[model samples]
Target: MEYTLDMAVLAILIAFCVNIVLCPVFIPFLTKIKFGQNIREDGPNSHLKKAGTPTMGGIIIIISFIISSFFFLQDNFEAKLVVFSTLGFGLIGFLDDYIKVVQKRNLGLRAYQKIILQFAVSIAMIYFIVQYGDYEKMHIPFTDKMLDLGGLYIPFLLFIIIGTANAVNLTDGLDGLASGVTALVSTFFIFVSWAVGSGTLPVAGAATGSLLGFLLFNAHPAKVFMGDTGSLALGGFVVSMAIILKLPLFLPIIGLIYVVEVLSVIIQVGYFKATKGKRFFRMAPIHHHFELKGMEETRIVTLFYVITAILCLVGYLGTAGIF
Candidate 1:
C-alpha cells in the first residue's frame, strides 16, 4: 500500500497538538498523584531544584500514541505489532518507576531484576517477529545485499532491544534530553518505515507524531520528565521497527548520540575502576561533559539534534540508495 505525504504530515500534526494540550494538564495531576522523580544526590547541583518534578509523563505519550494508533491506523498489522511491543516494554518500565516512586529511592528495580524482565520481553518480541513478520534477511545499510541470520537471529534481536532501551535510559540524565533526541530519532524512523514499504510504516509514523507532540512540553526546564517509562517504551518501539524492517544495524548510525552517551558512561566507569578513581570527563555522558565545559543547555541540545538529523539523513540515503 502506498503512503501519502499528506497522511504522514497529518498524523504528525495531530500527535503534536494532542501532546501540547495534554502535558500541562497532566503534569500537575501526576504530581498530585505522587508520581514524582527521585533525584540522585550525586547529580548536577543545578538539578536539585528539579527534585520534585512530575515523572512518568511518558504515560501521557503512550496513551496518546495508543489512542492515535487506533484512530489513524486501522487493520495495519505492523502498526499493531509496534504498539504491542512498545506497551510491553513500557509496562516493565512503569513497574520500575513505580518501585522508585513508592519506595522514595533514587534506585528502582535491582539490576538483575530489570535485566531479567527486559530479556523476557525482548525474547518474546523476537520470537513473534521471526514467526510472523516478513523478510528473513537483514539488510546492510548502503547496500542491496541482505544477511540471513537463520538460527542466530534471536541473539541479535535480543541485543538490539536491550541495547537500545538501555542507551535511551542512560541518555535520560538531563532535562528534555531523552525526549528531544527521541523525537528526532523517531522522525527518521518514520521515513525509514515508509521507504521500506513494510506494513508497520504507519505505526512508525504514528509513533513519530506522538513523540513530536510530546516534545512540545518535554523541552528545557521540563514540566514533566518522561522518566524510565517513556524512554524504555520509545526505545523499544524504535528497536521493534528495526527488527520488523530488518534494519537493526542502522541504529548506531541513526542513534549516534545515544550510542555515544552510553559509551561514555561505560568508559568512564571502567576507567575509574582501573585507575582507582581517575575520571574520563568533567562528567559522564558526552552531553553533561559539554554542559560542564560551559555550553548552554539549549545550544547543547540543538547541536545534538543537528547531528542526529544529519545521521538520520545518511541512514535514509543509505537505505534508499540515493548515495
Candidate 2:
C-alpha cells in the first residue's frame, strides 16, 4: 500500500465524483421513501419550508467515502480502525435517522440510548487503539515534545471520541453547515496526516471530497439534509484521523467550530438553569443566535468557514513545529 500524492488527490476526486453521482439517485430514492426531514418546531421560522426535504443523505457520503478509499485501504490496524470507527458511528446515525423518518419520531434515539451506543463504540475504539496504535505519545501543540498520558489514555480518548462525535452532531442544525465545516477540517487532516506519513490520508481525503460533493445539495435551500446519519459519522471520521495522527490536541484549534457549537449549548443550558429561565444567547449553538440577531444563514455559515480556515492555519503551523 504505497501512497503517492497523486493517489491521495485521486481518492478525493473519486469520492467527490461518486458523491455527485450518488446524490441525484439517492435523493430521489429517499424522497420516494418519504424520508423527509422533521424540522424542529423551536428552530428558525425560515426552516419550516424545508420540512419535506429528504433527510438521511449521509448514506451517500458514507458510500462515497468507502468506495473512494477502498483502493487505498491498507492491510493494517490503522486503516481498519479508521473504517471501523466511521462505520460504527455511521450505523448508529443511520438507526437514529431511521427511527426519525420511518417511525415518525421527532426525537429519534433517546438521549440515553444514543449515549450508550456512542460509549460502546468509543470504548471499543480506545481498546484497539491502546493495543494496536503505533504511538502512545500525544502531541503537545507549539512544541517539539510529546506527552505520555500513560494510564489516563483510555478515558482521555473516550472523551475526545464521544465529545467530537456529539459536537459535530450539534453543528448540523443548518443546511451545509456541518458538511462544509467538516470538509475544511478534513482537508486540514489530509495535509497533516500526509506530513506525518500516516495511513489515514486516504480516508481524510475522501471525507473532504465527499463533503464538498454533498454541499451541492446541502447548501442553502438544501434539497436534502444529512440528518444524524452524516453528522455523527463525520464526527467519528474526524476524531479517528486526529487520534491516529497524534493530533487530537490540535482538534480544539482546527475544529474550533465544533468546539464552540457544543460549548454554546452547554453554556446556554447552564446559564438558563442558573438564572432561572433567563436566556444567554438568542439561541444555543451560537449560529442560531446569529440568525436570530438578523444575520442571514449564508452569512453565518461563511463566517464560520473563515474562522475555521484561520484556525486550521494555526493548527498547521503548530504541527509543523513553527510555534
Candidate 3:
C-alpha cells in the first residue's frame, strides 16, 4: 500500500488516543507499586514536592507508538529498523528504571554497565544499517553536499546514536521539558519525512502524537515522570529516524535544546573542577540554572518549546535547500 498524508495523520491520532487512555491506568498502578520519583536533594528546592510522583511513564509512549505504528511496518524494513531500535534502547532504559525504582538501587545501572549496554545496542544498530542500508553519506545542512564516512561510518554513526541518546536523557531534568521538546522535534521529522517521501513518517507521527498525549500529565506539576526509560527511548527514536531518513546532521539544529542541555553539564563539570570547587552556572543542565535564577519551570519549558519550533523551521529550510 502506498503511504499518504492521511495514513500518517491516522497514525498520529491512534497513538495519541492510546496514550491518553493508558496514562490514567498506568500512573495509579505505578504508584500502587511504589514506582515513584526520587528528586535529587542537590537540585531545585521546589522539585522536592514532586517526589513520589509515579515514574517510568515511557512505557506508555512505547506501547502507544508501537501499536499505532505496527500497521505501517508491514513490509518496510527501514521502518522496522527504526521501531526496533527504539524498543532496544527503551528496554535498556526500562532496566535502569527497574533497578532504581523496584530494587531501590539509588544509582540504578552502574556507569560501566550502562555504557556497555548502550554500546551493544548502538553497535547492533550500526551492523544492521551497514548490512541492509545505504547510510554512509551524511547530508551537510544548508548545502547540497554529502559527506561520506566510508570506513569511518561505523564510528560516526555510533557516536551519533550514543551522543544523541544521552543528550536527550540530560534534557529530561524538568517536568514536560524532554517530552514537550521532543514532541516538537518529532513533528518536524514528520514534515520532513513526508516531504522526502520517507517510510519513517509513521514512526515520527506516532512519536509526535504519543508525546503530545503524554504532555497532558507531564506538564508542570506533573502527575508522573518519563524517567530515563522515556528519555533514552525518545533519544533512540529520534536519532534512529534521522539516521534512516539520512538527516542525522539536522539534529544539532532541530535538537538544539538537547545540545545545550548536554553542554551546560559539561561546562559545569569542567569549570567546577578547574575553579577548585567554584561553579559556572548555579546548576548544570542549564534548566536548573534558570530555575535557580527564579524562572518558573513552566515558563522555561514554554520558552524551550518555542525555541524548538523555530529551530525546526530553520531545520526545514535547510533540509529543503531554502537556506
Better of 1 and 3 by lDDT: 3
TM-scores of the candidates are 0.93, 0.97, 0.97
lDDT of 3 by residue, 137-211 (tens): 888898878878788888889899999999999999888999999999999888877877778888888898899
lDDT of each: 0.79, 0.89, 0.90
List pairs with backbone clashes in candidate 3.
none
Q: What is candidate 2's lDDT per residue for 1-323, written digit by digit as tens?
A: 55556767998999999999999999999999899998778888987898999999999999999998887885756767887888899999999999989998888999999999999999999889888776678889989899898888888898999999999989998888999999999999888777777788788888888999999999998999998899999999989988998888999999999999999999999999999999899898899999888999999988998999999998988886622
Candidate 1 Cα lDDT to native: 0.79
Give the residue spans of candidate 2 off by over 4 A. none
lDDT of 2 at 65: 91
Candidate 2 displacement at residue 226 in angstroms: 0.7
After aligning candidate 3 to the native by TM-score, how far in Å is the CA of 22 from where it should be?
0.7
Which pairs of residues collide in model 1? Answer: 16-213
lDDT of 1 by residue, 221-310 (tens): 777888888888988887888777778778899899989998999999998999998989878887878877888778888888889889
Ranking by lDDT: 3, 2, 1
Q: How many backbone clashes does candidate 1 have?
A: 1
